[model samples]
Target: MGNSVLVFAEVKDGRVKKVALEMLSEGKKMAEKLGGDLSAVLMGSGIESLAEQLGQYGADKVYVADNEVLKDYTCDAYAKVMADLIKANEPAIVLYGATILGKDLSPRVAARVETGLASDCTDIGLDDDGKFTATRPMFAGKAYVDLSFTDSKPNMASVRPNALPVSPPDESKKAEVVKVDVNISPDDIRTTVKEVMKTAGEKPDLTEAEVIVSGGRGMKGPENFKLIEDLADVLGATVGASRAAVDAGWRTVDDQVGQTGKVVSPNLYIACGISGAIQHLAGMSTSKYIVAVNKDSEAPIFQKADYGIVDDLLKVVPVLTEEIKKLKAEG
Candidate 1:
């Protein structure tokens, strides 16, 4: 018999990524429902210290493979290490974050392990028999379907960040740590991380933001983003961009949200001048409350929005901001 539930803990700068903890929570729940142990695997250079964080998230065991050659992400190197771990542990199920690194590493590992993989899953649950049933968007987000894997031992699934809420970590519980060595050569490593340029800020990432204010081509120019910014500032929300705005060079790719970009599910999503193409809606249809402001009364966005205002965003956004300010003052 092999391990029960195994989570791939993503490590950045010798620390576990937030989504890694979220997966551990999901794994913990699944393992409990199935009456098994939940394990986590961490791989990176000088990241043995991250095992404790996995324990906090309900991992019963932590397997770590630390080496300088595995310091950065390379498709070949990471896939090799992960495949070996899964082969040795033979976990019943494995979960990974749908982040860039995970998107690259998971498929290769799944192929090596000869298992079925569900990508960017929005929901996962244990059936009566304890099999993993994952749900994800299909047909360009028009609907969703449940996916199941029967012939696989370690059913692989990659889940979107912020799609599932993260449970708080418990520090009192401790997990057993297992150390492993990865054998890698220069020939196996293809890509090298040259430089990492991260945007400086305390602001939450768009995928994790509770409130998001987005702009589109109707905003006219990049300079016009100030209106969107003002509304975001008032609401303490992250700024997002439609593919049209990003293609127009009005915003960076990181700010883009759509089928070709990042998926976001915020508590409140405000779309200003966005036409709500099927692709764009695929990324944000999960938002709890949608508000669309566009001059075109016939825009498709209105159909999906909880609150629709058929007015020029330029005028309506300012008035909305002023009203918010007035309410704050009255309080």
Candidate 2:
């Protein structure tokens, strides 16, 4: 059989993660270039119904491992099953979404399968000889380097979430779903998920949101953060903060954005009063369009921002928000 490009179509809370859908597009492109089929491997209970949705993304086949043990995310159970599947049928390339689950699972699977794995890769492409070449940031996003597996039979790479644009879903496409049965005992599972406690909020998840409004120390204090929140509310963007603001106790740790915090790559990132240190820029530098507003014209954020406004954030934010609201109301 010709080598196939396999992707892990991860699902959470009964919905397919956007990163997985993004991978299908990349996987399809890679498979076409390599002259092979694209297969998506889905592991979880009661997810067989999602196989059809995978086909619209250009998956030639969908492999599912549905069992009660695989219902909740467990490192041991997922890794064991995936390793067994890989050993049984070798794929030329395996692409995983570099999400929380993928970051935790890809390295373990790579070690178990004895293959080269790259993490947080921003880009992956095929070499002239059908080999995989990837690019990933290094030194806390200060620089980037190329990665590849020259000797491994299967090349593995975990791409960052939101790194790729989503393609329109084409329901006209069709694919075959293959079910893989695996035996799992309680002893094989070392850990059990008692409960998952997520932050209660109506706002979208920061990492996955398309737009974000972030603030720094220049916001004066936590009370002034409402200005940032007001703009975010108008734009339907998530709220983020710089490490300076977080360390100063002006914002919660969950809202912090930097190399030490969550890595976000949104479509539009608005920086209000953030001085843009290298560490803070490490997190949101990959955003598509950056708009920075700060009183300091010499702030480093202006270097990377697509648009810059030198003004007092407190004076400028409310006016900008209302202008956007007015445009929306009229449009």
In the predicted model 2, the residue pairs found to clash are none
CA lDDT, every prediction?
Answer: 0.87, 0.90
Each prediction's TM-score against the native? 0.89, 0.96
Report the lDDT of model 2 for residue 1: 24
Per-model C-alpha RMSD: 2.7, 1.5
Clashing pairs in 1: none
Model 2 lDDT-worst window of ten: 200-209
* Best model number under TM-score: 2
Question: 85-166, model 1: which lDDT tens digit per residue?
Answer: 8888778889998877888889999998888899988888788887789998887678898989877778899987767778
